[model samples]
Target: MSVLAAIAITTGILSGVWGWVAVSLGLLSWAGFLGCTSYFASPKDGLKGLGLSIATNLSGVFWAMVIIHLSTWVGIDIVGYVVTAVVAFFMCIQAKHNILNYIPGTFIGSCATFAAAGDWQLVVPSLLLGGVFGFAMKASGVWLQETLNKPDTELCEEN
Candidate 1:
C-alpha cells in the first residue's frame, strides 16, 4: 500500500509537470502521457524499462506509418483494411523478439501516432521524452517511499 501511495503521488506531480512542459513547448501532453503509461507496462524497470518502452513503442510508430503509406498507396477501401490488418499481425507477432516483447507499448505508440495524424516528428520526441519522465516518476516515487520509511506488515499476538 505504501508503494502504491508513492507511485500515486509521483504520478500526480509528474503528470502536472509533464502537462506544463507540453503546454510550454506546444507539445501534446496526452501523447506523452500515453508513453509514460506504457512505461509501467514495460518488461523491466530502470534503464531497461526506458529502453524497451522507447524501442517497442517506436516500432509501433513505424508500423503505423507503414499502414498509412501502404494503404494510401493502394487507393482502395478493402486494400486499406487489409493493410491495417496485416500490419497489426506483424505488430503482435513482434513479441517473439526478447527486446520487443511489450505489446501494449506498441499499441500505445501506434495510437499516439494516429492521434497525432501520423506526425512522428512531434510524437517521436514527445514519446522519447516520455520515457525519461516515466523513469523519473518511478525513481522519485521509490525514493520517496524509502525516505518516508514504513513497515510492510505487522504481526499480532493472540491473548
Candidate 2:
C-alpha cells in the first residue's frame, strides 16, 4: 500500500477506537489524539518515534504534576509562571539526550495536562492509551502492506 493509503485507513480505524474510548469510558479522546500525534511528529520516526513520544509525553505529565503540586502548596498563583518557566528550561535542555530529544512533544503533553485542569487522573491514562493506538495504527498498516503485497511466488510457497 502507498503511504497515504495506509495512513488513511489506519487513521480511520483508530479514530473510531479513540471515539469509543472517549464516550464509553468518559475519557478525553482529544488528549489521546495529541499523544497519538506525538508519535508521528517526533524528531525521529518508526519505533524510535514511538519511544520518544511515550518518554517525552510521560515526562511532561510528571513535570506538570510537580508544578501543580508545588503551586498549590506555595499558595501563590503567579508562582506557576516561574515554575513552568523553570520546567520549560529543563525540557529544552533535556533534548541533548536522545530519548527525551523531542521538546515539542513534551510541551504538547504538558499543555494537554494543564488544559485538562490538573487532572492527572484523566490525562495520564488517556495519553498513554493514545500512544498505544498510534503504534497500532502504524504496525497494522505495515502488516497489511506486507500481507497483501507479497509476491505470487511467496504466496505459492506458503500454500
Candidate 3:
C-alpha cells in the first residue's frame, strides 16, 4: 500500500515534469490523502479504504468530463474510466481475497465515465488489461501455493 502511494507520487511528479502539471498535482494530492487515511488500516480495511478512495476520485473524473464536454475534448471522458477499470481489474486479480469487495467502486467509476463519454472504446482495452492481470495473478498464486506446500522436512534441513 505504501509502495502504491509512492508509485502514484512518482508518476505524478514525472507527469508534472513532462508538462501535465495540474493533472499530476491533483492526482498526487489525492493519493497522499488516501495514503494517510489508510496508514493504520488492516489489509481487509485497506481494500475497503481503497474502494472508498477511488469512489471519491471518481468525482474528479466527473468534473473533468464536464469540463471536457464543454470544451474540445468531447470524447475523452472514458479515458479515466478505462484507466481505472483496468487498474481495478488487475488489483482484484492480484488480491482475490477481497476483490469483489471493490465492485461498488468499479461500478460507480465505470458508470460515471461511461455516462460522461458515451463511448464503448473503453471496454475492449479494459477487458484486455483485466485478462492480463488475471493471468499474472494465477501464476503468482500457483507459485505461492506450491511454496507453501513444501514438506516440513525440506524446510527444516540442517543449516
Candidate 4:
C-alpha cells in the first residue's frame, strides 16, 4: 500500500480507538487536501498549495463564525446568502492566481471544523495534528518516489 494510505488507515484506527471523531475528520480532511494538491498542482508548487489549503481552511472557519454571529443579528436565511457570497468572492479572488485549486480540501476542512462545533480548543489541535500528518504523508511520498527512481547501484552502494 502507498505510504499515504497507510498513514491514513493508521490514523483512522487510532482515532476510532480513542473515540476522537473530530481528530479523525480533521486528519481525513488534511489527507484529502494533500492528495488534491499533489494531483492538481505541480510538485514544485507544494508549498504554494499548502499555503492555499491553510488559507482556505482558516477562511472557512472565519466565515462560519461570521455567519453564526450574523444569524443572531439578521436571520439564518439572509445570513446564509451573505456568507455564501463572501466565501465565493474570496475564493474567486484567490482562484484568480490559481492558488485556490484545493477548494475541495478547504471545504472538507471547514466541514471538519463545523463538525467539531467550531470549538477553537478542539479544532485547533485537531487541525494542527492533521496538518502534521498531511506533511508527513506528502514527505513520505516524495521520499518513496526518489527511492524508486534511484539507480540500483545507488541502493546497493554503502553510504
Best by lDDT: 1
Clash number for each model: 0, 0, 0, 0
Query: Which pairs of residues clash in candidate 1, taking residues 3 or more apart in a chain or in different chains?
Result: none
In candidate 2, the residue pairs with backbone N, CA or C atoms under 3 Å apart (3 or more residues apart, or in different chains) clash, namely: none
Residue 145 lDDT, candidate 3, scale 0-100? 58
Order of quality (TM-score): 1, 2, 4, 3
For each candidate, what TM-score against the reference?
0.90, 0.87, 0.25, 0.59
lDDT tens string, model 3, 1-159? 244454454444433343343244332322332222322231333335544434433433443344444444445667756655555455345334343344433334344344436332343223222222223333344455555667888878833
Candidate lDDT values, in order: 0.87, 0.84, 0.39, 0.54
Worst 10 residues of 4 by lDDT: 35-44
Compose the digit string of candidate 1's lDDT tens values, residues 49-154.
Answer: 9888999889989998998899889899999999999999999999999788999889888988899999998998888877788888998999888767744342
Give the higher-lDDT candidate: 2 or 4.
2
| Stretches of model 1 off by over 4 angstroms after superposition | 150-159
Q: What is the lDDT, from 0 to 100, of the residue 106 in candidate 1?
A: 91
Model 2: lowest-lDDT 10 consecutive positions? 1-10
Query: Model 2 — TM-score against the truth?
Result: 0.87
Q: Tell me each candidate's RMSD, in Å, in order.
A: 5.7, 2.0, 13.3, 5.5
Residue 115 in candidate 4, Cα distance off native in Å: 1.5
The lowest-lDDT stretch of 10 consecutive residues in candidate 3 is 33-42
Candidate 4, residues 39-153, lDDT tens digits: the string is 3333233556556666555555565565556655676687778776786566446545555555554555556556756664555455555554455556556566666667889
